[model samples]
Target: MSAFRARPPAIPTTLVDDAVTRIIRWDFEPGADTGVHTHGLGYVVVPMTDCHFLIEEGDSAREAFVAQGAAYRREAGATHNVVNAGSEPMSFIEIEYKQAL
Candidate 1:
């Protein structure tokens, strides 16, 4: 009786039950920052809103303009600091794989 039907599910990357996949939502006000940290596993990010990002690696830092609904992937073990450089609140969804040590 519905006008629209649901879509099928997408293929998963891993099959292990213990392999952790999580979605994290970040909200940053203007001039807010996330301190330097190292990622334990690979991650994919999708920005929910437009943002100006300042990513710092070691002593060097780069500025990027991230548009809404943009997807990006990153390698594991990467370290960086993130800063919000826009006038509005910046938000993004982060999906990271979990691995046991």
Candidate 2:
């Protein structure tokens, strides 16, 4: 198996008119994972490479094998832990929207 690799946030934070937008690109190798985190604002994920994702939700968890070019949306304030389970590196683009609370 290849060593796990992670990419840092591309755009930590940005001001867009009345709202703040954040963009990040991540690369995960097999058996790689991102520790638990919370999403304050809604987010959209666009996969650049195929990946098998394992998501932990509370006491339960779900797994999904997404193909390249797949797109997903997440609800605001959602929290979860993610893991990558695939032979090749998994890359994705994450876009977050932040508004005045």
Clashing residue pairs found in predicted model 1: none
lDDT of 2: 0.72
lDDT of 2 at 81: 72
TM-score on alpha carbons, each prediction:
0.75, 0.74
> What is the C-alpha lDDT profile of model 1 across 24-43, one tens digit per residue?
67777777766667988788
Model 2 alpha-carbon drift over 4 Å, by segment: 1-19, 99-101
TM-score attained by model 1:
0.75
Q: At residue 71, what lDDT does model 2 achieve?
A: 92
Query: Model 2, 42: alpha-carbon shift in Å?
Result: 0.2
